[model samples]
Target: MIPKHTVDRLSNRLTHLKPILSFEIVFIAVFVTLVFFTGGAAAQAPVGGGGGNTSGWETILDNLYNVLYITLQYAGLTILVLGFIVWLSARNNSQRSETGMKLTMGGAAMVVAYFGLGALVSLLEFIAG
Candidate 1:
């Protein structure tokens, strides 16, 4: 049988985590929706690449991609620097150390994902072709 105190602690942790989880779910849903709509719109639009006439939808997508790529690069760099600082400062506290490690790893993963995104897209295109 589980101890009552342990169960209580677990319940408290779950309550605190609920809002964070909900926010993550909502954020993911919105991102997916935007990407889906943008992709569908782009696909339906006719392609034009002659005599200096470009498709507006494609231009919008290219601008959006550029902005997002730049933003991610900056964000990833900030996370990496902050995570390393936190990790170095929290060496005396186990909980803080653990949190720091998680942040560091998450930041590193984001950076890696940013770098790998083009390769991933290329792989998908190759497979689809």
Candidate 2:
């Protein structure tokens, strides 16, 4: 069991971190939005050279999927690293430790979801076929 003093300290640290965490989340959201918009625009823009026949919608979807996949991969890695640092630094605080573990698991889940997307697409294709 964690001591009261450790819990108090961890609470104080979390209070200080709350604003920073909010800002990080907002920043990530904005970055992702920008990536999506820009990627969408680029995907829609006409190519100068003629390419083999392909559906424009399919091309756009592929680009969007790639961008999202890469973004999530990086975000998950970043979250996992941050969670590890927090976990290591909050050894004495059960609350902080739990929060860190949750973050780590969430990040891992994101990465897994990213990879699983391909399988999901394949499954859909098979079903459609």
Best candidate (score: TM-score): 2
Q: Which stretches of candidate 1 lie above 4 Å from their native place? A: 1-54, 121-129
lDDT of 1 by residue, 24-101 (tens): 799999999999877776556455645545667568877887888777778888888888888899868988878878
Best by lDDT: 2
For model 1, state the Cα shift of residue 78 in Å: 1.0
**Whole-model Cα lDDT of every candidate shown, in order:** 0.80, 0.83
Least accurate stretch of 10 residues (summed lDDT) in model 1? 44-53
For candidate 1, the per-residue lDDT at 121 reads 67
User: What TM-score do all the candidates reach, one by one?
Assistant: 0.52, 0.55
Deviation of model 2 at 19, angstroms:
7.4
Considering only N, C-alpha and C atoms within 3 Å, which residue pairs clash in candidate 2?
none
Per-residue lDDT of 50-118 in model 2, one digit per residue for the tens? 575457767778888888988988998899888888777886899999988888888888889877987
Off by over 4 Å in 2: 1-54, 125-129
